[model samples]
Target: MNATKYIILLLLLPLLFGCSNDGINNNNRYLPNYGFSVDINMELPLYTNLQFTGNPVYIDQAGVGITGIFVMNTGGGYVAYEATCPNQEISECSGMFLQGITAICPCDEAEYNLFNGQSTEKEFPLKQYRVEVVNPSVIRVFN
Candidate 1:
């Protein structure tokens, strides 16, 4: 009788704590894993505008997904974001445009702050890449 009681308690321990699907159900796995490296030479004509603060540029490079990427200078540092709308399903209209310090999605008017990748109207923020300043005039964006 004692052995049976101990066995039942061991089996019931897991049920008492319960289980949650919160972490196991991460939805980001559904999103494609697109990775690329972009080197921005601020001295170049195409990226010269990025040398100044509050300026942004869009680049369509390989591995950047359907919308490419948006890079900006925030006066203090450089930031890069995937130019796709986080709220909408992947489509042609899901591309986002840089408007000052915000990235706007024309499809549904979804806005995301470039400074921190926070979406103003949605729970999921824009996907961001790692930016590294290789030198005074060069910056690298990578996944």
Candidate 2:
């Protein structure tokens, strides 16, 4: 009500909203924030298989994703997902395997659709990275 009281209230206002999760990216907690990014050059031997549609390519490189990065061309576009199980923390068994059209988590046998990163048995879907076609010959995946 008074000038002193208003000053104190204003000073404390920002503190009340500081140091919180903000809740926008709450799902990143499930896996370590190792970062997911890769540039797929279709002409390279390692990524030559990815030039086709519906073929899933699993890259087990370190520091790319939690377990690794799984990428595929869904006929519509390219998509990438973190290779760890979305429902749990990163563990020895939390790394998923690429099946025909799904990523199967060995920890709990949770099956996630690779097309849209959805799973019926888990509350969270697979963590997807952003895909950008850099050129006709290359595409970059990142989060």
Candidate 3:
């Protein structure tokens, strides 16, 4: 009886310390959280460049992201990230511009890798969204 009780206590101990927060505890202080969904057709003339790897395209119309979104063809697949710099609050200079495989933030000259969205100068990473390839010609981004 004593052995059974000890085993039950050990099993139930993990339940007592229960998770303090919901599974989704992530809270980014700088970047604004904006829900958006966008789809791009690679066949279109404007987005035709995306068909090639290492090319990134900026989409800024209606509902793409807070300021805009930068979608890139990483050769392996696709990646989409918020255009605003993740290190600081959205300011006039927070909008990032692409230069080769990196997005540069003019405010502090912070650079982020377009392929992985990792920062070269800081620990802040670009806000990324989920990408789904509807077909060979169409890709969707949502968060």
Candidate 4:
């Protein structure tokens, strides 16, 4: 009986370790679902920077919070992040700005990386959305 239990435990160990929230994080609190769409044209002057690698842009549309969306080109692909200050109440000062390669929160000054939404100063990472490249010229951002 003990041998059978040990075998079962060994088998279950791999499954338990595989089921992890490695890439996805739900650290943002007190946020409401405010879905929006953004269609970007790389040819346009406003979005021409996205054609280059490691360039981030701030879009002031989408989400129920004060901040909008922080979009960037990671060379591998495009990524979109919620510009709201994570783990804080939605308020006027909760919007974040794109400072170099990091998202700077106005209220608490928490910084998050635009590439992978990892927090630099705090434990909570910024919320992110799905980005789809419709074509070489067009990109869509949605949550």
Top-TM-score structure, candidate number? 3
After superposing candidate 1, which stretches have Cα over 4 Å from the reference?
1-30
Q: Flag regions of model 3 displaced more than 4 Å.
A: 1-27
Better of 1 and 4 by lDDT: 4
Task: Choose the strongest candidate by lDDT.
Answer: 3
TM-score of 1: 0.74
Task: Compose the digit string of candidate 3's lDDT tens values, residues 43-129.
Answer: 999899899999999898777788888999999989888888888878999888989888999999999999888885686788888
- Predicted candidate 1 versus true structure: per-residue lDDT over 1-143, tens digit per residue: 99999999999999987875422221443245576787889999999888988878888876665468889998998888788887667877877887888889899898888877887568777776778899999999877
lDDT of each: 0.79, 0.82, 0.85, 0.79
User: Cα lDDT for residue 50, model 2?
Assistant: 80
Worst lDDT 10-window in candidate 4: 20-29
Task: Give TM per candidate.
Answer: 0.74, 0.77, 0.80, 0.76
Which order, best to worst by lDDT?
A: 3, 2, 4, 1
Error of 4 at 107 (Å): 1.2
Model 4 lDDT tens row, 1-143: 99999999999999989775436555455666566777888888988989988899887854422467878999999988888887678888887888888988888877788888887567677887778899998999876
Better of 1 and 4 by TM-score: 4
Q: How many pairs of residues collide in each model?
A: 0, 0, 0, 0
TM-score of 2: 0.77
Q: List the candidate 2 regions with Cα displacement exceeding 4 Å.
A: 1-28
Give each prediction's root-mean-square deviation over alpha carbons: 8.2, 5.5, 5.6, 5.3
